[model samples]
Target: MRVAFVSFETVHHRESETNRRLQTILELLSEQGHDVHVCCAQFWDGERSTIKRTGISYHRASAGLEAPTSFLARVPFVLAKLGPDVVHASVRPPKQALAARWGGMLARAPTILEWYGDGGITNDWWTRRAARWADWIVVPSELVETWVRELGVDEATVEVVPNPIDVDRIDGVSPGDSVDVVYARRLDADANLESLFLALAELRTRDWRAVIVGDGPEREAYEQLAGELRIDDRVTFAGACSLEERLAIYRGAHVFAQTAEHCVFPTEMLWALAAGCVGIVEYHADSSAHELVEGWDRGFRTTSEEELVDAILEAGGLARRDTDDRFASYDAGAVRDRYLTIYRTLQDSSSLV
Candidate 1:
């Protein structure tokens, strides 16, 4: 099958969850003999507009900030020439979703839109228009599925497929102390890092340290909060690290802590769990991330601050169990095959009718 992905950001241009996910998918699809083309923007200098990597073709969108808009404008032309069977997009960028809808129509192909947000955008004029225009909607969790349905998307057009984690890419290395806790994610209030830092402070009685990975707008505030709690010396604000470096950190840690207030299933959590940190942390009351580790016996879960502290202490002390059983369904190949199922279904002439 010929597939053209309409993305504002490419893996080479940006290092993000979407970039990583798309790279995995496109590479796998290309390896499987599918003609995969990624229409995206170039992030750095001397970057060619069209480059091929691992059998996938990447066509740079534009030279300006309005690249996504300009790229969408050319999707029809590109699709006309490439004549792909499917056009993939996302709803995060309202403009890209809207444009992909129009481009798919121009190319007479089915456009699949991944809606990762919990809020229903169906009521918003532009979002609703894009949602209506999208041929099929793919969401990661049931929570998001319900939201998209409430937004007036056709029920038959929506499907739930969790994102994939490159299990082989992660390192399952837990330190001997087992009190080495790590928080790997963007530093945002929504992440509930305030609660995490406070909980870490409470656990100061133990000989433990924390490695906070990733950088975001809340960096300064989190740093200040750590000082106020007097646990600054025990924590390391590592900022962001490369994927290999991140996996190594997760492996060396005994526990991975996450405190999200509201979030779709985070890809970071999946990678951490895969890398063998006896994951600990309660799912935010309003978050869908809880679903990721709901039944896994390899980690811990809690809701309140007290429970979080207790879980951390308990899980940190416990020996690492075989995490293979927990990540059975999330294997990179298995998840990619599930997506392949969707693509094949859409490609079937009967499904269109």
Candidate 2:
């Protein structure tokens, strides 16, 4: 299959959850021998209009990120010329998705917009129009699907596609020294580390050690809070870790905590669960993290610091496992096939029309 991805910016421009997801899908498609192309403002340095990297092709829709109108103006033509089997786009810079929709129309291909519901301008008129104009809208969770439906888009047009994880990679990594608890996410304002810290403080008398595996501007503040709670010695703040390092830690950990105040999809929690750690998600209105643990035996959903503490303690009785095969469906290959199925179904329906 030939797929064209339309985004005003990409991982090369800035690292973000949306960009990472797009990059992963593109790489997965490329690995599966599908011809993949990305249309966006040039992020690579040079006057060249196109470049090929790691088996994927990138075509410049504009001179640079400074020119949004130009990017929107040229994307359709670029995609039409590429003539992909399908056009998949990110829902940021809403105009770009609209442009991709136009491109899909020109090329007689289906267009799908992926809505991450992360930090971005999503409440504008352009977003609603893009949601309605695209042939399909893909969201990471039902929480996001509901938000998209609220935009006046038909419920049938929105699909819930969970973020993909690398189960094979998790299985290949060796477990590190064991720890009783693990919390991993960028220590930003919404990290909500305080909840987990307070829960740990409540159980200070117990014999347990926890590790916070991420780094951000708020790391020092969280560390200070840990000290204020007098649990600093027991909680290890291991700064941002690589994929393998994190997998190893998750494998060795007994429980993984998800306390972030906002999450469209709990990517790290999925990783931890696949690594065989008992999942403990603190409910948040704006977060869909709890969806991952629903109906799962090894997962626990908590609403308060007290519940978090209780869940962690309850997780201790579960047998330790090096890996869990339950999440194998979330593997990159499986998720790639899901995208392919959607594309083929759309292609057939469009043909019938």
Candidate 3:
């Protein structure tokens, strides 16, 4: 089967979860012997042509192209020319969905629309229309399912699929004996890094070291908070690393803590669990982290700074249990089979049609 992925920009062009998922899905399909072509928005440093990386074939448009214009104008040409068995347009919230619809109509191919963000509460009509046009809708968590349902898409069309991760890359490292708390998220205003810094300040007397990875606008503010609390020496900021380096940090740390005000999916927390870290999260009732903590009792959950501090201290006491088996279902090999099943079902339906 030939699959065409219509992701405008991916890790091949940008370092992001959307791009990572697009690349991962392409690799998995390619490994299963499907002819996979990834059409991407181009980058500056020479990734505009066809390049094969990790068993997946990628094709890119020119650099600095706007999402709206390019999706409407350029994508149809690629779809008409490639002639794939299925066209998958991932995370089409606005204009991209229209392009995907047009592309599918012109190519006469079944299209799968994927969205990982929350729905329902947001009053975005374009996305709702896109949901209607899609042959199938894919989301990472049940929280997203609720949102999609509210958009009035048929229940049969929406499918719950976990975000795929390279579980083996996070596996097999023995956890350190001393308590090391790790947080790997963009240090932006919405990330709520201040709460974590205050919590860490509360834990300065305790036997623990807090490491914050990734960088953003609030780095200086967070550093100031750490300095004010006099815990700056104990807290290390390891800003933005390669995939291997991030995985190495996850394996070396004993606890993973995050305070995202409102995130649809906590990908970093999942990685921490897969990496054998005792997970701690600060999430309110409406957030997706609540769903994660509710399902997996392994992690500690809190909403306030005090509660977060207590949870961190509690995480120090929690015994490190083997988590590789629990997260095995999310491994690339297992998820690849799951996706193959979806593709086969799509193929069978097309054959009947």
Candidate 4:
């Protein structure tokens, strides 16, 4: 099958969960013998408009920031250039998908819009209009499906397809003797780092340390909070690390904690669990991240400072059970097969019926 993956952003241009997912999916499609092409706003070379990698072709147009008002102006050119059999767009929804739908219509090909999150622009006029225009809609989680349905899409038009992580890309290395815990994510209030720091302070009786990774608006405030709690010495603000370094931190940590107040799909948590960390999620009303730890038998979730402290204390001292069993289901090969199932089904189905 000739597949064209259209996205507003690409991981090759930016290191993000969405990009990682696109790379994984494109790689899988290529490995499955599908002729795949990726189209997006390129930021890799700053000025280069196009490039190719592995078996997939990449076409870069204007940066999203440069043409927010006229985003679809370049779609016709990209479509004419690629001439895809089926266009699969990776998008959060409405705008990007809408652009793809318009471009696909002009190009006379089926278009599938991929949604990864919820609660953003679902009610926009373009979102509802474009959703109705697409051949099909794909979402990564049940939570996102529920939200999209609320936007008036027929249940039959929406498919629950998860964003997969490259489980094999992560290697589990010894966490060393430092008794360290790592929490990595953009430092935003919604990330709930406040709760994590307070919890860590509560567990100061232990000799454990924490390594916080990433940077955002909340970096300075979070740093101040750490000092106020007198736990600065035990904590390290490592800012952001490259993809390679983040994985190394995952393998070296005794545990991984995600304290986000709300999350559509927490791909980082998946990496942590895959890397053999005793995964822990801080709960809120809008989170379903705990679901990832369901059968892993390798982690738990908490809802408050007390619970987080207790879980950390326990996870730090508990005998490390064999984690191999926990990560078996998340193997990259198995994940690729999941995508193959969806792609094969779509490929066999009639176009734009």
Candidate 5:
């Protein structure tokens, strides 16, 4: 399949959940020997408007990242020129999605929107228009599916495709030094580390260690909070860790805590669960983190600090494991197959039309 992805900005310009997810999908498609291309603001240095990287071709839709209007205006022309079998677009600058839909129509291809619902235009009017225009919308969770449906998009038009993980890469890593509890996420306003910290303080009398695995603006504040709670020594703020480091930490730790106040999809929690950490997620109104562990035996959901403490204690009883086969379905290959199925369905439908 010749797949063309439309994104105004790529991960090369800035690192974001949406960009990273799109890049992963593109690479997966390329690895499978499919023709993959991305139309975005030029991120490479030179007079060249097109460049190839790791088997995927990137064509510039605009001169640079600064001009949104230019990026939006040129996306359709670029994609139509590329003439891919299918067009996949990121749902950020909502207008670009509309442009991609137009491009798909011009190119006689089907347009699918990947809606992470993390960052993008939030105006109901724009979002609703974008959702309605796409051939289909792909979201990370049912939580996002609900949001897209609320925009009056037909339920059948939206499908939940989870963020993919590298199961083989995870399986190959060796577990790091053991710790009693593990929490991984950017330490920002939504970190919600306090719940886990307070819960840990409650168990100060117990002999257990915890590791907080990430870094951000709130790192100092969270570190200070850990100190104030007097669990600083026991809780290691390991800062931002590579995937290998995080996997090792997850494999070594007995329990992984999910306390973020908001999550489109609990990515880190999924990784920890795959690494065999007993999942303990604190339920938040806006977050879909608990969705990953709702019916799973090795998972626990808590609504308060006391409950978090209790869940941590209970998870201690489960036997430690270095990896879990249950999450094998979330492997990169499985996710790529899901996308391929969608593309084939859309292509077949387009042919009949």
Candidate 6:
């Protein structure tokens, strides 16, 4: 199948869950012998119209690009020319994804609109219209599924597909040499790193070190909070990391604690779990962390700062458990197969028409 993946930006920002998902999907699709093309708003070194990574033909069009008559720009010409069997896009703020969705219509291909951020996700007029227009809405969590349903899209058209975990790349490693708790997320209010700091403060007397990965606007504040809590000596701030560093950090850590207040789908947490870190997450009703860690002994859910501290303590000493058997359904191969089947179904439907 020939497929066009329309994204805001995948090459420039690789750490983001959206980018990660796009890369994984494209690679797996290419491996499965599908002709895949990537159309992003931004590409390598800001260069436009170049193919990169896994033989994907890359194209670009500014979301804000317009004609002088004040008419909105039609779908990207490159995408329309490709005329893919299916046009998939990641919908988010900045309205560019909606533009790409329009481009899919111009390309005359069935579109699968992707949106993963769900908690506190509000739709505007254009978003609602795009939701109605797309052939299908692919959401990563039940929370996101709810957000799309709130837009009044037909229930049948909304599919809750969890983001696939590359289990092969995340196989459990032997326990590290020393005990170190790990927290990997963009440091921001939503991440609620303060909770992790507070929890760590309680464990200051314990023999453990923490490596906080990822960077954001709240990094300074989180650092300040850590100093105030006097755990700065024990915590190392490792800013925006490469895929190799992140994988190593998760695999080497004894505990991986996530303290987000409202995470739709915690990608870092999932990776940590798959890498055999005894997982602990601050519980929230809206977080997909709850959904992933539910009924699993390797993961513990905490309600408050005290519970988080206790869970961390328990997680630190936990032995590596075989999680592959438990999370097999989320294996990248399984998810790739599911997507292939979906694409085939769409193609078959179009042929029938």
lDDT of each: 0.74, 0.92, 0.74, 0.73, 0.91, 0.74
Q: Lowest summed-lDDT stretch of 10 residues in model 2?
A: 119-128
* Residue-by-residue lDDT tens digits, candidate 1, 13-90: 666555665677787788778889877665546757787878988776766445566766775676666677888886
Model 5 misplaced regions, further than 4 Å: none
Model 3 clashing-pair count: 2
| Candidate 6 regions with alpha-carbon error over 4 angstroms | 8-20, 39-53, 60-72, 76-80, 92-108, 118-120, 171-175, 321-325
Q: Model 1 off-target regions past 4 Å?
A: 8-20, 40-54, 59-64, 67-73, 95-99, 102-108, 118-122, 171-178, 349-352
Model 6 C-alpha lDDT per residue in residues 241-333, reported as the tens digit of each score: 876567777777777887887777777777777776787878876777777777888788889989988888777666854344666678889
TM-score, every prediction = 0.82, 0.98, 0.84, 0.81, 0.97, 0.81
lDDT of 3 by residue, 1-353 (tens): 88887777677556665556666777777877888886666654664466776676666643445654755577777777888777888764355666766777777787888776642245478777888888888777777788888889899988877776787666544443343788888888677888888888877877678788899998898889889999999888989877667777777777888787767677777777787788788875445766556666567878789998888877777766534467778778888787667767776787788
User: Scored by Cα lDDT, where does model 1 land?
Assistant: 0.74
Residues 1-353, model 2: lDDT tens digits? 99999999999999999998889888999999999999988988878999999999999999889999999999999988999999999989788889999999999999999898887336679888999898988889988988898889999888888889988788789999899999999999999999999999999999999999999999999999999999999999999899999999999999999999999899998999999999999999899999989999999999987788889889989999879999999888889898999999999999999
- Each model's RMSD to truth, in Å? 3.6, 1.1, 3.4, 3.8, 1.2, 3.9
Error of 2 at 164 (Å): 1.4
* Each model's backbone clash number: 1, 0, 2, 1, 0, 0
User: Model 3, residue 61: what's the lDDT?
Assistant: 44
For candidate 3, the 10 contiguous residues with the lowest summed lDDT are 170-179
Instruction: Write out the backbone clash pairs for model 2.
Output: none
Error of 1 at 246 (Å): 2.4
Once model 5 is optimally superposed onto the true structure by TM-score, how far is the C-alpha of residue 349 displaced, in angstroms?
Answer: 1.1
Predicted structure 5: clash tally: 0
Arrange candidates, best TM-score first: 2, 5, 3, 1, 6, 4
- For model 4, how big is the CA root-mean-square deviation? 3.8
